[model samples]
Each structure stands twice: as C-alpha cells, then as structure tokens.
Target: MARIRVLTALKIKRNLKPGMYADGLGLYLKVRPGNSKSWIFRYRTGGKLRDMGLGPFHTVSLAEAREKAEVCRVMRLKGLDPLNERLKEQQAKTIEAIETITFEKCAEGYIAAHKAGWKNGKHADQWTATLQTYVYPVFKDKPVAAIDDTLVLKVLQPIWRDKTETASRLRGRIERILDWARVMKYRAGENPARWKGHLDHLLPKRSKVAAIVHHPALPIDETPGFFQILRQEATVVARAFEFCILNATRTNEAMGMRWDEYDEQAQLWTVPGVRMKAGRDHRVPLAQRSQRILAQMQEIRTGQFVFPGGVQERPLSSMAFLMLLRRLERKDITAHGFRSTFRDWAAERTDFSNEVVEMALAHTISNKVEAAYRRGDLFDKRRQLAEAWAAFCAGTAPSKP
Candidate 1:
C-alpha cells in the first residue's frame, strides 16, 4: 500500500475554509470560515462522486468518522448509494411519527378542517380559546406523537372537576385532534384523550363534578312581561334578545341567525346542522308573531345576519343581549335562563309530551334506548305545542287543538 496520509488536528485547524477535503480512508473534513469543522465521507457510487456529512468533529472524532466511512465504503461496494440510503432511512422515521409534528401545526390544521362545520362562528372561537388556554402552553413545542396520557391529564384534571361541562367538551375536542394526528400518521396507537371506557375509569364522571355558577333566572310568569318591556327597548340587540326568548333559542344562535334560514312560505325557520347545539338540524315552527319580527328585521337586514353588529360582517356580541336585559331592569335574568322559562311554561301550561318540548328546545334526550326506538321528531305535535306557547307569550288564551 502507498504511504497513508493522515489528518492531524494541526492540519485541520490550519485549513479552515468552508469546504470538504479527502484525508485517505474515505474520511474528509468539512471546514467553515468561522473555524467550525465537521466530518464527511467521500465515496464513489456507480462511478459517481458523492459526499455524506457524518457529523461535527466534536461529536464524531477522527476514529469514529473513519469507522462510519468504512461502512459507507462497504455499502458503495455493494452497489448502494450511501446518500440515497441515508435519505430513505430519514424518510421512514418521519412518516406517521408524532415526533415530527408540533402541537401548533396540528391545531391549525384541526381548526381549518372543522371551523366551517361548527354550529356557529362562536363555536370556532370557543375551540380556539380552549386550546390556547389549556393545550397550547403544554404542547406547543412538543411533537404530537410524544403526547401521552399524563400530558393530557395535566391539562384536563385542573378544570375537569370545577368546570365539568366545559371540561368534558374540551376532552372531546382534544380526542378529535389526536385522532386526526393518528389518521395522518403524526401519532400512533389508541388516543390518549379517549373518555368512554378509557378515561372514564380514570377520572370522575362529569355529573359528579361540582356545577359551575350560572346567572339566576326570572320566574316563568315574569318572562312575557319582560319580553313586552324588551320589545319597547329600541336597539338591534334588544330586538334580538326578544326574538331569542320568543323563539326559545340560545343567544348566539339567535344573534347569528341568517336571512336564508327563514322560510316565510313554509312558516318555519330551520337552524342548519352547523349552528345547532346538538350538531343536528333543528326546525322552528314560525308563529305569526315570529313572522312579524322577521318582517321588521328585513327592513334592517343590510347584511347576512339578522342582527348585524356595528363592525362589518360581525354578529351582535353575546353581552349585547345581556345588556339589553339589564337595561330593561331584569338583571336577575340570563339569556340562557329564558330557555328554562319556556321549558317550565310548556310542562305546566300545556299537554305537550316531554320529548316534544325537549326536541323543540334542541335539548338532547339522554334516554339512549328510547331515542333509538323513536325515529320521528313529533313535528306536528310540537307545532301545536308551539302555537299554544306563542298564544301564552302574546297574552292570549291557549288555542283549541
């Protein structure tokens, strides 16, 4: 063999230009102008010249570089391209691995895919707020695949007991995102956020958790008088609040109501699947008074929403309805509590069945066995019930069936 040309440390320090140099035995030095030095392997693959960076000199010593280079030489001799082989290995590790994806990246993708399908625009805002508050801080920098049960529990346990309803929803949302990650191969195995049989055994049931404080509601008898005063209160927000009570829907659902959702001909207003609380479509039988309110709203329907805010293309704020209630000197009542008023009134003052009343208010009936057996929405019976409710709210005697 010819005399060996070894690379001494002194020679590496002297030639510190940013390039690679052959130092016999397939080892080479990649020198940078800043005196930073790394090692590379020079080899021929199919009569082609190629270079592969091994690592920094500090991390990979001269001996180690030579050992790695010998492996590359053998691979080349066996007709394998070292660079192509290394790339293939890297690609394999990246596929379907949570270690490669960040929480922020997955969150953005989750929001994009599901935002439009949300029941209301505020649903999207709520999802973003929960992630920002709980999930983002913990996993923003972490790879999605690395998130485990312990990590998920850390974000959930703090609020799970105190804010059970919201916490339960947040848990479901978290499971959805992790499921998306798994489907995309950014994560693997069963979802860490699963609840039904998995997390259920670990955490207390949501119903067992302490209830959150809500604004106390006015008695049912006081609602019609409250509505009368609310009608005279001249503001888009006040009118929207009155409509919300009359329709017995949620504040956001009413304020976010669109002109297209109305059917003046059919005397119905159908909240689309994306906007209903149950994520199912709801049909509201439009009473004559509700139709009159819609007609009045048409005069101000300059935009898509019935109650457009001052800002362009924005719906009225949730607080706006509450403020109107306050201005009417009914601070004791809540916008959501009006639904309770309607439920009480329907139960006490009418002959409508519990299912009809529950479905009318878009409340999910919890009796799974009963729900599975019952296919019909009892729309006709509910229409008759709604007519009776309308008469009661309008200060008229109940209509004869």
Candidate 2:
C-alpha cells in the first residue's frame, strides 16, 4: 500500500528522522539523522533492485519528485537500469571534457617511453635537463590543457635571446609533449608551441640572435709552443686533444674514436655516418702525427674506443679535453678553436685550395652548384697539406722530409 503524498509545509514542521516514507507514485522521502530529506526512486530492472536519487526535498517539492519517479519507472520497465544509465552518461561527459595533466607528469611519461631511441644516454639527459630547468618551473603544476601561448612565451622569451639554440629545442619538446597529451586524451586543441604563423612574428628568428663567441685560436706562430706544452701533459685526454688538433676534427668525433675505424694499410680514419656531424661517412686522411698517436694508444686499448674513459667500457667524456686544456692554463683557447688554428695555418701558409682545407677539417661546403660538380675528395692535395702541417708541428719542412 502506498502512503498519501505529504505536502512540504507539513513535512518541514514534522522534522522526520532517518528512514524512507512512501509518498505514492514510486517516490519516497529519505530523511537523514541530521533531519535532511532527499527524494529517491525505488524500482527493479531485470529482477535487480535499484535506487536512484532524484533531488533534495528542499530543492524539489513533492510534486516534482513524483514527476521524476514516473520517468524512472518508465525507464525501468523498458529494460534499463536507471542508476547504471545515469552513471554511464556521467562517464561519457567526463571523457569529452578536457582536464588538467601537469607538465611534469607528461614530461616524465615522455622521457620514459622515448629515452631508448636516443642516440646516446647524454642525449636523453640533455632533453630532461632542458625541461627541468626551463619548462618545469613555469608549468609544472599547471594543467597541460590550461597552457596557452601566453604561458609558453613566459618560458621561451627569457632565454630566447641569449640561449636561442637551447630555447628552440625546448619549444619543439614542449610541442611534442602537448601533442602526446592530446593523443592520450589528457588535453585537446591546437599546439601553442607551433612557430609557423604564431610565434614567428612574436619572436626574432633564432638565426638572427647574436652568435656565441668562443675563445679565439692562438696565432699561427704560437702553434709550436702550444703543441710542445700540450705534449708535456701525460694524460690520455691531452693525447686525445693533440690527436684532434693533428687531424682537425671536433672533440666529440675524437672522443668516440674507435680502433676499428682506422685502416693502417689505407692510411685513413673512417668515421661512420652515424657518428659524423653531417650524417655522412667522413674519411680523415691520417697525418704522420695522427698515426703516431694511434700507435701509442694501441698499448692502452682494451675495448672499442681508443680513448676509453675511467669506466673502461665507455668513451672519454666530451669535457675531458676542455678540462685538460684548463689544467694547462690555456683555457683561453677552445678545443674547437684548434680547427680555426688549422684553417688559419692552411690558408696563410699552404698553396691548397679552399676545398682542400675544408675537406681536411671535414666541413661540408654549402655552395650547392660547386658541391654538385666537385665530387672528388682532392685526396692527393689533402695528403700534401696534412704532411705539410705535420712537418710544421714537428719544426721541419718538406725539403727535410
């Protein structure tokens, strides 16, 4: 039997306790111990009992609860669970809505998934360091969905002028993480880090930023004295630096030098395309001094790399050369500046063409027309240049050779 529907005016004065009072039409008043009353509907779907809350007593009057109950009763009769259907609808709405996933979380997930694909562990560390230093402090707590152009500008604008190269990489990384978040349903919309039509106008071109000034090379006359001082240092790093200068190669290329890359018979060091900066195989014509250094390194070689670090298996760190230079009190000259020194000596002292000099340094000349026509490596000209430079370092000339 169903009870008569009591008007709110009577129920408000009566102060009902925690229990359900049938109010007819499948609607009932559920009162709490605190005397708060809410409207609920009791019904069955596929022999299963279900209770659905309609509204609070104060919000929905007895008349309104009755109307809502009739709708639920109809829904129940149609083979639907009113409670289950309501929950499903809520979940669907949640899926469509954008929510905040912090930048820190997104970056962590990104690094964990993609670190293995990086060329080296240092590459992974570099990516993490940039985000930790520049991006995380600005957007760590902020939801990825809430980040906009204004927030992104705050991160980039400070270093955009001074550290353009690093800032450029940071911008690309930010865009990648946001794109990943969107694909994972954490956020959705256009990527704010995009530079094409958006940030291009707002910021100066990265190329236009002031070029980083490195320590200039010592004058050509100072080469003999510098080489003499470098030779006095007995560390493997000093030997490596000497080898780098003799070959005119970058520090990274030298650090990762492998014994297998050398061919004693061919008298050449073949740096693989993966290790070369231009991503092409580079053949360095071995000078007399370079050959001597390799022969000396063979006594210590226990693994793949010629200049293995203290750990035995790994290559010497890129900083190893710089630290050695600092110890010699010649920190004014950079390890890379030796290439400039070699170039200066070649241009001022030798009769070799610019192509020969550039080839010796393993630099890619960008003149497309000339590059297309000039396929030969000028190996004979380079051999003469390398021998001449080695002679200059040894304080002798070709007349003596």
Candidate 3:
C-alpha cells in the first residue's frame, strides 16, 4: 500500500525538466525557465496552496530535500505554516559551520528580520538600545546555545524591581532571540527566557510589579472636558487627537489611518489587520464627529496617511499625540488610556453590554473557551454605542464640579 519512490538522484540528473512532480503535496524537482534546476515544495495551509522553494538541485541532494520536506510536514501537523518560517531552512544550511554563534549576532539578525514589519524605525531603535545597554554588557558575545535560565535572570534581576517595564520587554526579546537561534539550529532545548512556566517561577508576577505606573486612564467625567480643550486647538494634531477620543482607536491606529481605508458611503473605516494591535482587520463604525474629522483631514491630506507629518510619506511622529497631551497640561493621562475611559463610560453611563464595548475597543478575548462559544458579530450594536459615546462627548457640556 506504499507508493514507489521513482525520483532518485539518477532520475533527477537525467530528467531535469521544468515539470517533474516528486514527493508529497506536489514537491517537484524541476528546471526553471533558464534550466536552473530547483525544487519547489507545495503545501496547503488554511485551504490555500503555498509554494516553498526548497533550493537549487545542484546543491541540494535527494536525502537533504526529503529531510526538509519532513520538517515542513511536521510543522504543518502542529498548525504552523513552514512558508512563514522559511528562515529555518535557509539558516540551517549556513549555521552548522558556525560553532560559536553569539547572542548579539542572533539578536541583530532577529531585529533585521522583523524590523520591516514594524510601523516605524522607533521600534528597531528601542530594540537596539535595550540590547546594547542591558543585554550586551552581560552576555552579548557569549555563545547563544550556552545561555541558560540563570544567565537570563542575571540580566533581568537587577532591573526587574526598579525598571519593571524595560526588564519585561528585555526578557521577552531575549526569549525571542533564543527561539530564533534554536530554529536556526544555533541552539536547542527549552527556552530559558520563556516566562509562562519557567521564568514565572523565577520572578515575581508582572502585575505585582508596582515600580512603573502603566498608562493612567483619565476619569470618564474629565474626558468630555479634555475633548473640548482638544477641539479648541485648530492644529492637525489636535484634530487627530479629537478623532482618536471619539472613535476610541489606539494612537498608532489613529495616526496610521489611510485615506483609502475610509468609505464615506458605508460610514466605515476598515483598518487592515497589519495596522491593528489585535492583528485582525477591524471594521470601525465612524461616528458623526469621527466622520467630520475625516472630512476635515481630506481637505489638507498629503500623501496616503490621514494625518501626515512634516516628513514626506510619514505619518505623525510617534510622540505627536503625547506632546499634544502635554501641551493640554494632561501629561498624567496617556492617549492609550482613552480606551479604558471609553470602557468606563460604556459600563457606567450606558446600558451597553461589556461584549459590545469590548468589540468597539477591538480587544481580543483571551479566554479560549469563552471565545469559541461567543460569535463576535456585534457590529450594529457597536455602531449604536459609538454614536451614543460621541453624542455624550460632543453634545453634552462638561459635568459640573
């Protein structure tokens, strides 16, 4: 009941045509247009066909190709698309010759590999600064494979108590680098930087770390006063901030809003999954004030962004909204905390259920069991909630002290 293996080294050598199907999922050892022999591994992921180029046949042997196909098959079984993780195969080839791969090298490679996906250079800059300042001093040149949990804790322990947020992000970055190294065949075994089961036992819970006060939400009653103040200013930054408050969108989401994403007829703003924090395309129901802000931005729109900055082809600076808040004399509250403010208003002032409010905020449900049972199809209700919140903020006067 087993299919005979017909495509061997001799067969590949003789019949190097452009269309030679070999192994599982349409794995083909074929010649490209110019007779450059290549192997392409095709597999189905999420009901879609994906072709993964294995390598040139001249360099890749039959046994090696089979080995890679097996790895992809295993990944597919675990619900991971090997196409996304193509670096694994590419790195494995060059990595075996590298005996002493350093953590710094891996860290740099990780940043280089992923920095393109980040919205701006600030994220890469932060990664570089943290690694150079905190991690490099400890074990930057050390062989990444030899890095143990003890080493990870050593880097984190000094700042864990004093600089909780930085330390937390540092630990996660270390973990990701180690993971990347492992996948690239530079290291092996359990990830020492992982926090869930391993490092959680080593360090105090993040929630218990009280040194850094995270985004402090403005009081629900004070939001209207703040919104009115923001509206008084005629600057584009102020208009962007007003739009943010009215829609309850994140700072990046608000700043990164594209002209093409807004549909006037539908009164909808379709935020591509790449731009969203939840990593899913979100359909935001634009309120009257939000629509008005869009219309205002259209009058002075430059490039693709709804809120373009001084720099060409760039949105507003990452700190633009923060600086706006500081000018408004509200440095105590963050732009991000507006989501919490909106949640508070929804729960206390209105009869809207928590689910609708959460949908409006684009908060992905964490509980798998709860998520599986509940269908997140509360768009119409969220529209009503958005309109109500807009009316309360724009129409009503600030609450009397």
Overall lDDT per candidate, in order of appearance = 0.81, 0.83, 0.84
Q: What TM-score fits each model?
A: 0.70, 0.67, 0.71
Q: Report the lDDT of model 1 for residue 79.
A: 79
Question: Per-residue lDDT for 70 in model 2?
Answer: 83
Q: lDDT, candidate 2, residue 94?
A: 79
Superposed by TM-score, candidate 3 places the C-alpha of residue 284 at a distance from the truth, in angstroms, of: 0.7
* Model 3 lDDT per residue over 1-401, tens place: 43434477776777455665565545667776666787777888778888888898889987788878788888888988898777776677567556588999999999999999886568899999999999999898999988998788889999998888899999999999999999988888999999989999999987788545657999887777777778899998998888888889999898888889999999999989988887889999988789998889899877899999889989898899889888888889898888888888888888888888888888899999988998755888878888888877875632311
How many residue pairs collide in each prediction? 4, 0, 0
Candidate 3 residues lying further than 4 Å off, grouped into runs, are 1-97, 397-401
lDDT of 2 by residue, 1-401 (tens): 64556545576547777898877766778889989888889876567766789999879877788889888878877877879889999987776454646878888888888887665678778888898899888988888788899999999999999889889999999998888888878887898998998889889898798586665787888888888888888778888988888888888889898988999888999888777777788888888788988988998788999988988789898788878878888768888888888899887877777888998887887998988898888887787787888778766653221
Q: lDDT of candidate 2?
A: 0.83
Q: List the residue pairs that clash in candidate 1.
A: 96-185, 98-145, 119-274, 119-275
